[model samples]
Target chain A: MSDSCCDGNARKAQAGDCCAPDGNVMLLSCSGGSNVGQLANQACVELTQEGFGKIFCLAGIGGKLSGFVRSAKDVPRMVVLDGCEVGCAKAIFKEAGTLLRGYVVLTDLGISKNKDFARKREDIDQVKAAAKQASQAQV
Target chain B: MQIKILGPGCPKCHKTEEVVREAVAEAGVQAEVTKVTNTMEIAAAGVFGTPAVIIDGDVKVVGKVPSKEQVKSWLGK
Candidate 1:
C-alpha cells in the first residue's frame, strides 16, 4: 500500500498524487515513458470518453498561452497526473499558479515505469476504472 | 524531438497517438512520443484542450487531433 500523501506530506505528493477541492476539474497526465504513465494517460482518456470531463492541455498551460492560461485560471478546478513519482506533471501547473483540483499517480495502480512506450489495452482499461473512481469520489 | 498528444484518451487522443506513431515511422525519425493527461500537468504543459500534439516540446496542434500529413508538416520532417 502507498502512503496517504496528505497535505502533511507535501513533498511526498508526487506529480499526480495531490488534489484540490474545487469542481469543473481538468485532468492532466504525465504520459511519460512507462507502462503506468500510459496508464495515467488511459485514465484521462476513459474519463473523457465517458463524457465525465474533457481533457485539457499541458503545453498550452506551460507556455502560458493566453487562451489556455486564461481558461485554466477561470476554471474552478484542475487535476494533474504523473505516470510515476517524478512529479513532472505537477511541476507544470505549479509554475503556472493555476489551482490543481486533484492529483493521481499511475504507479500507485501497480504499473511501473519503463522505457517501452507501447500502451497496452488492459492497462488503459484499468486506468480508466481508476479515473472514474477518482472522479466519482471527487464529486 | 518531443511528440505530445492531447485528449484524455478519448477516441481523439488514441487516434492522435496512432497518427503520431505512423508519422514517426513515415519520417523514419526516432522521436520521443509523450501523452499528457494530467489537468495540472496539461496546464503546466500549457494546453487547454486534449487530442493535441507537441513536436520537440513545442505545441503543434490542440483542441483536435490532426492528420498524419499535418503532424508531419508540424514536425517539419
Candidate 2:
C-alpha cells in the first residue's frame, strides 16, 4: 500500500498525508497594530517556542505566494488566531481558499481590543489557552 | 522555459498542473511543465505554500492557481 493509504489516515482528504513531515501544526496570528493583536502575536510565538506549533508568516500567505499557500492547504493542521473581531488572519486564509483546522479570537476570551492596552502575562496566558483549545477541537 | 509547479500532489496542485498545460497549449509556447511534489524539494525551493509556479528556477506565482492569462503572461507569450 502507498504511504498515503487510507488505513488509519482518515483525515487525509482534509489534512495531508498522515505520514508526511508536516507534523508541526502551523499557527497564524493577525498581529495587528493593537494591544490585543500584540497579545495574539506573543502567544503564537510562545506556542512555537514551546513546540506546540510553528508560527507561519501571514503576510507570505496573504501575498499569495504559491508555496506558502500550498503548504497551508496541505498542512496536517493549522490554527488561525485573531485579535479583536477583525479576524484578519482568518480572512487571509479564507481569501487564499485555505481551510483552518483551528481558530481563536482574543476578544471572545474577554480580552478587549484597544490601542493602549498593554500585553500582560495574564492576557497572554488566556490567549494561549484559547489557542490550545482551538487546536484540540475536532475539525 | 522550464515551468515547475510546487505542491504535494494535492487536488489544488493537480489543478495547477492542468492549468499550466492548458495555458501552454493556448499560448502555443515552447515550455516544459514540471510538478515538484516532494515536500523537501518544495521547501528547498523556498515554497512554504503549495500550488506555486517556478519559472526557470525562479518563483513566479504562489498560493492559488493562476488564470490562463496570468500563466501566459508569466510564460512571456
* Candidates' C-alpha lDDT: 0.63, 0.74
Off by over 4 Å in 1: A1-25, B1-77
What tens digits encode model 1's per-residue C-alpha lDDT throughout B1-77? Answer: 77766444455567779988998899888788877655555555554445456676556654455688987776678
In CAPRI terms, model 1 is classed as incorrect
TM-score per candidate, chains pooled: 0.49, 0.61
Model 1, residue A109: C-alpha shift (Å): 1.9
User: Could you tell me how far off, in angstroms, the CA of residue A28 lies in candidate 2 after the best superposition?
Assistant: 0.3
Candidate 1 has a DockQ of 0.06
lDDT of 1 by residue, A1-139 (tens): 0112221334533333232213234666877667777677777766666655657677677877754754565544455678887877777778888666567777778876787776788777767766656656645
lDDT by residue for model 2 (A23-128), tens: 5667788989999888988998998888787788888789887557766776667778889787898888889888866888889888888999598999998888
- Minimal lDDT window, size 10, model 2 chain B: B42-51
Q: What is the lDDT of residue A124 in candidate 2?
A: 91
Q: Considering only chain A, what is the TM-score of each predicted structure?
A: 0.69, 0.81
DockQ scores of the candidates: 0.06, 0.15
lDDT of 2 at A95: 91
